[model samples]
Target: MPGKRPLNAAIIPSAKRERKAITLDIKLEVLRRFEVGEKLSQIAKALGLAVSTVATIRDNKEKIKASSQVTTPLRASRLTRHRSAVMENMERLLSVWLEDQSQRNVPMSVSAIQEKAKSLFDDLQRQQGESSQTEKFSASKGWFVRFKERHCLPHFKVNSTSPGSNADTYPDVLKSLIEEGEYTSRQVFNVDETGLYWKRMPEGMFISVEEKAEPGFKSSKDRLMLLLGGNAAGDFKLKPLLVYRSEDPEALKGYSKPNLPVIWRSNKKAWATRAIFHEWFTYFFCPAVEKYCAQNNLTNKALLILDSAPCHPVNLSDLSDNVRVEYLQDSTADSMQPMGQGVASIFKAHYLRRIFEHILEATDGEDKATIREFWRNYDIVDAVDNIAVAWEELKPATMNSVWKKIWPECVHFQSFSQTDNIAWLQRNIMALAKNVAFEEVVEADVGRLLQSHEEDLSNEELMQLERERAVGEGENEDAPPALRQLTTEALSVAFSHFEAGLQILTSNSPDEEWKFKVSRAINDAINCYRELYNEKKRRSKQLS
Candidate 1:
C-alpha cells in the first residue's frame, strides 16, 4: 500500500467508453460525488467503496484533462486524426506479428516503426506551420512501444546450448525413436535452472509519466539467487543458489561454510569454483532427476532438455544409458522451451501470489510489509513450500483438455517443419483463447451459484485456519485441539476447491475420470472435518 497510487477518473471518448463501459460508469459516479461538497469519506461511504476509490477517481480526472488538452494550438482535429491513424496501423501490425512471429515476417523493426511515426509528424509540419514533432513523436512512440511490449514479443522457448551450434541436432537415437512413433504425444520432461531474487522488482512494473524516475534511480545490487526447475507441466521445484562477491582471486582457499557470504576487495580469489556447480548437480539436479524418473516410471529413453549453463556438466556419466540430454540453442529459448513459454511464467505468478498472501497474513490483514525485513527473513525453504503447494494445485488435465480442443488437427510424431510448427502454434494460441472464454463462462456461473453460501465462515476463522494449516503442527502441547481441527477442515476446503475447479475445467474425459474421484475425496474429507469443527464450535458457544 505504501507504493500505491490513486486511480484515474478521467472520461474517455465514445469509442473508449464502449470498450470500458462498466469501468467508465464507476469512475463517473465517483467523480460526480467528489465534485459535490461531500467529503471523500462521505462519498466512499455513500457508494459503499473505499476512500481510495474517491482519490483514484479524482486523480484520473486530472490526468485525463491534462492529457487531452494540447499545450500547442495546432487544430485538435489534426492531432486526433493522426493519433487515430497511428493506433489503427499499430493494431494492424500487431495482428500480422501475432500470426507469424518469426522475426523475419514482422511488419517493421522497432527503429523503422519509430521513423515512420516521426515522418508522420514531419508531413504534418509541411502541411501546416513549422512545429516541433518531438512531443507528438514521443507520444506516438510510447504507444507503439507499449503495443510491441505487450503483444509482439516472441514466445518463450528454452533449448539446449547456444544458437549457431550443432548442439540442437536430434541425436540418431532420438530420430530413430521418432521414426518408430514411440515418442508421439508422450510427455516431455524438461529440466533447467533459473535464479530467483529476493526483493527484486517483479516483472512488468509499469511506471507512468508522472512517476517516471530519473536515470540510475535504482540499481540491481541486492538480489538473492534461487535455483528452480519444472517440467512441461507448470510444476516448480526450487532450491537456493548461493552467491559470493570478491575482488581477490585466491580467497576461495579457506572457504568452507555451506551458506557463508564471502567478500574480498583485493584480487586474491575472485574466480567462481567448479565445486559449486558440482554441488548443485549432486545435491539438487541429479537427485531430482533420479527421483522423478523412478516415480513417474520414465525409462532412460525419455527426452531430457537442458540449457548450456556453465554449471551443467559436459558429461552425464552417472545417468543411465537410456536417458539422453537434448541441448537447446542459445538465446532461442523464447521459441523452443516449454518452461520459458509457460511453466516459468506460471511459477513466477504463483510465487508472487503466495508472497502477497504471506505479506497480507503477516500484517494482520494489512497489505503492507517491511520490504527489508521481508527480504532478510524470506526463507527459500518457505518459497519452495509455497511453490510445491501451488504445483499440486495446478490442473494439468484441464490444460491438456484445452490443448486438445485447439490442436484437434495436430498429428503426433510428424516432422513438423518450422512453418508447420508456426501454424500449429497460432492455432493452439487461438484455441487457448476459446478455452479461456469457456472457463470464464464457467467461473461466472460458479460465482453466482456460490454467492449465497460464500460467507458461511467468518474472516477471522478463515484466517486462523489458513495459518494453522500452513504451519501444519504445533511445537507445544498447549495448542488447542479445536485449532488443529479447524486447520484440517480448512485444508480440506482448499483442496476441494482446487480439485473442483480442475474437474469443471476438464469436464468429462474417460482418461481424466481419476480427477473427479480425487475431487469427491476432497469434498468428503471437507464435509467430515467441517462437521467435527461445527460440533466443537457449538460446544464452545454453549460453554461460553
Candidate 2:
C-alpha cells in the first residue's frame, strides 16, 4: 500500500532466461587463453560467458578436447551429451564412400545419398547384431543437412556424370595452397598407412607340408597397420603409429609402452580405425608438430596433407587452431601423396632389410637350425625393435627427395632415387635370404611380399577379424600373466652382490675422486633395489 503511491516504486519480476550454449571452437579458445595464464573471469567476459561457465568448461577440458575429434557439426553451439557409436562409425564410413564415388565421377543425387546412408546404417546394425531392437533410421533431409555440415561438404555434385570427368587436379590445388599459405617444406606434412606382416617371411621360404596342414599356420597373413609420415623437408619423421590386434600382446608384457619408439595402439582387426587416428592426431601428431615448430623457430601453424582414408576424421582441423588439414583428391593419393611417392616403399625396404639383419645377427651367418629357432621365438617386441631401427635408418635427404613428385621445390638432393635405394635394399635382402637357406627368395618374391600387404583379406580372415572385433567390443580382453615375484632371499643375495661389487671397485680404484664418483653412481642406480631389500627386511622383522 505504501509503494502503490508511486509507479516507480513498484517491484517488477524478471523472467528466467535460457542457458547459452558454447561451441567447440569457443571452448578451445577459452582453454588456450586459460593455459596462457589468462584469468577465468577475463576469459568469460571476453567470450560473453559467465565466469562459472568458463570454470566449468575448464574443468571438463579433456572431455571437451576429445569431443572435438569425434563430434559432428563441430561449429554447432548446442551441447550434445552423447552420440551413438554406430551412428558415428556409419557417418565416417559413409563419408569415405561419398568421396570414393566423387573420385570415380559417379553422378549422385540427394536421394542416392540418403539411400546410401540408410544402407550403411543397416549394414552397421547387422554387423553389431542389434538390428532387431535398433530404431529405424530414415536418413531424412534433416540428417543429410547435418551430415553435410559435419563433413564440411558444400551443396554440389557429389558425383559426375562421366568417368574421368573429374581429372586429378589435386597437384594444382596443393600447389596453389602452398603458394597462398607461403608455406615452406617444413610447414607441410603428409601421412599414409601401410600393412606390416611382422612375422611373415617371403613365400620363397617353403613351408613343410606338416607345417602347412597345422591350424592357423598363415603367419604371413598375421598383419598390423603402420601409419608413417614426415614433413616435406624430411628432417622430421614422426614416430611410427603402429596398430596391432591385441591391446597388450604377450611379447610386450614387461615393456613400458610410453618408452617404445613407435606410438603403439590397438584395434580388434589390427586395421586403422577412426578412434586410433584421432588419438594419433591429437596426442602424437599435434604435439610432435608443436615441438618441431618450437625447435625450428618457425610459426606454430602447419598444413597436414592426408588421403581420403576412412580412418581419418573430416573435422580434424577443428581440433587444433594452429593446424589446417587438407585432403588430396580421391584416387589421386597414389600419384600425389608425398608418402606414396616412394616414402612408403623406401620404408618397407628399410624394414625388410632390418628383418634380414636381425636374422643375420641371431643366427650368425644364418645357420638354418638357429634361424628357424629364432623365427619361432620371434614376437611383436622383436618386430617393434626392428621397426624402430629401420625408421632410424631413414636419412633426412631420403625423406626430402621423396617429395620431388609432389613438391619439387622441397627436394634438395637427387643423387639417390627411391628405385636405386629399394633395389640396393632388395639385393641385400636377397643375399641375406640365401644365407638363411632360402636361396629361392628373389627380388620379385620380396616385391610380392611387400605387395601382399595390400591384398584384400580372405573371407575366413574377415571372419576371424570380426570375432576379434566382437571380443574387443565386449571388453573380454585376457589379462597378461603376472611375472613371478622375487623372493626375499633372492633380493638379499642380489643386494649383497651389489654391495660387494661396489667395495671391490673402491678397493681396486687408483684415483679417489673417480672411485667416489663410480661408487656413488652405482649406489644411486641400485637405490631402488636397496629400498626393496629394506622393505622385505621390515616385513620379515614384523613376521617374527
Candidate 3:
C-alpha cells in the first residue's frame, strides 16, 4: 500500500547518481529561543546538529588551570629566610676560627681545619634530614679556609726573651751634634760613587729574543767609574777613580794624583787593599770637603752619611771632632737616603739618554777616526753639549727657576712641629743642586756634538737614494753605465756590510756579542768602501 504512492521525479532521480554538496549561513533567531543558558544538548537539538559536534567545541574553549607545584608568596619568603640564616651561620664559624688563632699562639694548618669543619657540619646536616641534597654545606668549608689565611698568619710575631741593648741613644746624639753646629754648610758634604756600564739596557726594550741565545749580551765594552762629591750647596765635583792592583808592594807606596789615588796592592790575595779605603777617605772625600770649607770661610765640622762599603772606612781617632759618621741601617736606604728618593732617579734618566743619543750620532760619521774621537772624547765638552740641547728642548725659565723646581722635589725636611736634623738638611739641599746642574751640562755637551756631526746624508742614506734612483729609471735595456755602476757600488757597499753588522749584533756567542758585532760591522763597511774604490779605478783604466 505504501509503494502505491509515487516518489517525486527530481528527488528520486538523484539516488542513482551522487550530487555536489553546498554550505549556507544560518540565522540564529530560531535557535535563540531554545533556553535561557542553553545546554549543548538543547542547542544542538534545536540546530539539528549532532550532540558530539557541539560537545567538541565546548570542551575546546580556553580554561585556566592552576598547577599543584607553583611557588607561592610564603614559599618564596621561606627560601630567602633560609639563605640568610645559612650565610649568617657561615660568617659566625669564620669569626670563631679567626679569634681562636689570635687568642692562642698556635698555628693550625688550613687543610686540617677545613676537613674537620666540613665533617662536623655534614654530620649535623645529615641528622637534620632537611640537609641540602645537592651538596652538604659548601659555603661553610670555603669560609673556614679563607678566614685562617687572611686574618691569622700575619699577626704572629716571634717573642724575644733576651735583654735588648739601648741602641736608641744614637738619634739623640746625632740631634745634639747638629744643634751644636758641628756641621758647617760647606764642610758638610756627601760623597758616593756610582757604577755605570754599557750593559744598562732601556726599560721595555730589553727583550729576550729566543733566537739569540747569548748570555749577558751588552752593546759595548765602554764603561766609566765615576766618584761624585757634593757639599751642602749641591755643587758636583766629579773624579774618575780607577781601581787596579799591582803585584809589587812597592807599587802601592805613597803617591797621589789630583783627583785620584795611587794603585794599592793587597797582602790578601782574595781582597782589595785596606789602603784603598784609607786612600778614598784621606785623599778624595776628606780633602774635597775640607778645601770647600776653607775656600768658603766655613767651619770644618762636617757630618758624612755613607754606606758600609769596604772602600769607605771610619776611624774615630782620624776624624776631626767636628766631622761625624752617620752609618745608615742595612737595606733601609729606600726610606733613609735623600738621594734614593730624588737625585739618583733624575741623574740616571739624563745620563742614559745622553749616552744613547751620543752613540747614535757618532755612528753616522764615514771615518773610523771621527767616530773613535767622538766616543773617547765624551767628557766635559760632551756633558756641556748634551745639557744645552736638553735645556733648549725643555725651555726651562731660568737657572733660578730650574733650581726652585728641583730643590723641593729632591730635599725632604721634617715639619717645624718636629725637630729636624740640620746636617742632613744642608747635605740634601747641596746634593740636589749639584746633580741637577751636572745633568744639564752633560745634556748641553751632547747636543752641541750632535749638531756638529749633522751632515747632508750618511752612507746608509746614500744607498737608499741610489735604490730610489734605480726604481725611478724603470725597465731600460741600455741604462747609462756610469749611473748604474754608481748605484750598484753604493748599495753593494752599504747593504752587505749593514746586514753583516746586524747579524753580528744579534749573534749568540758571548765572546762575539753586540759590542764586538758593532765593531766588526763598522770595519766591514770601511773595507767594502775601499774595495769599491779600487774596482772603480780599475774600470777607469780599462776604459782609457
The whole-model lDDT of each prediction reads: 0.41, 0.74, 0.40
Candidate 1's residue-wise lDDT over 282-317, tens digit each?
A: 444555555555566764244455554443555653
* Candidate 2 lDDT score at position 229: 88
Candidate 2, which segments miss by more than 4 Å at Cα?
Answer: 1-168, 207-211, 365-369, 467-473, 476-544
- Best of the two (2, 3) by TM-score: 2
Where does the lowest 10-residue lDDT sum fall in candidate 1? 262-271
Which residue ranges in model 1 land beyond 4 Å of their true spot? Answer: 1-187, 201-220, 233-287, 296-301, 317-319, 365-544
Go through the candidates in order and give the C-alpha RMSD of each one to the true structure: 26.6, 16.3, 35.3
Tens-place lDDT digits, model 2, residues 105-161: 344689987887787777777777854346578899998998898678644444434
Better of 1 and 2 by TM-score: 2
Top candidate (lDDT): 2
- TM-scores of all models? 0.32, 0.58, 0.32
Tell me the lDDT of candidate 2.
Answer: 0.74
